[model samples]
Target: MAKISTTLLAATALIALAGCAKKRPAVLPPAPAEQATEVAPSGSAGDVDPNGGPGSDADFRRSVQSNTVNFGVDVYDIDSTARAILDSQVEWLARYPQVRITVEGHCDERGTREYNLALGDRRANAAKNYLVARGVAASRISTISYGKERPLALGSDEEAYAQNRRAVTVIIGR
Candidate 1:
């Protein structure tokens, strides 16, 4: 009789615990629409592609000096070096008015996930704001933060950390 009672109690506890488990939702939100417009072939005579064709990612990279800007440790301020790089980006963006870009912020793998994410966001915004201030349209840019989840350099040394702490501008559409 005691064995039967103990078995019954164990089964009841197991069922109760199973009932507490939560089910994840199946539906997901739709992706946002692309912000850039297609470039017309005869839009402007001066808008000729430097490489081969306008509105291509390769053209944008080829036109700009650099697509990335590095930040100091735990800092999001745009220094003179970063400013120069973004200025070049702004000039390239001016030539390709229909182009759209995404600025991705990243950080070294030292801080907590939450902290790094926040820092990364600030870094991305800093770069975006600089571009907008220098005549790039605000609507043509979007920002995302990867924090320390995506590292340019995998090593744990200071050099690797410096490389990892950066914001990269990616040509998304045109």
Candidate 2:
């Protein structure tokens, strides 16, 4: 018992001496916050956000009223439902001037390639024009026709066709 007590006293004295030694400043000061260092809407993975919006592609879609509007087969006209969606989009745009978008016109797999491309162009333009008319800056919006190349749903049935015939509003930048 006496040996154990002596050993413990030495260990405690050594620990005390070790604690008295000075330590170098191991931590650096935090980097200064800079707005310029913030992520831009270059479509990089980091820029997109949900709260301030104009975020990443998915977050931007969720931030907006509607990211897609469907159309009837072979039609480029904007229906009432389509109009409402565009209206919501316009409202969202008004709130976020930094945001820019690309309207992608897609078609079902039923039409000829050339025909589908034409239809997609018309559809994309229709949505773009609607936004322009509703106070969205024309310069902030661009249109592209994917035609039947990119299908949201893959099948020969009407359900898949309907799902494929849509104009997708993509967030291009902030």
lDDT against the true structure, per candidate, is 0.83, 0.79
Clash pairs, model 1 backbone: none
Worst 10 residues of 1 by lDDT: 25-34
- List where candidate 2 sits over 4 angstroms from the true fold: 1-56
How well does model 2 score by local distance difference test?
0.79
Residue lDDT tens for model 1, 92-171:
88877877888989999999887998999999999999999988999999998888888889999999999999999977
Model 1 residue 20 lDDT score: 82
Q: Model 2, 1-174: lDDT tens per residue?
A: 999999999999999999989565334222212112234655654454634444545565666678899999778889999998888888777766766788989999997777888899999999999999889989989888878877899999999999999998877665
lDDT of 1 at 123: 98
> Which runs of model 1 end up more than 4 angstroms from their true locations?
1-52
Give the top-scoring candidate (TM-score).
1
Candidate 1: RMSD over Cα atoms?
A: 5.3
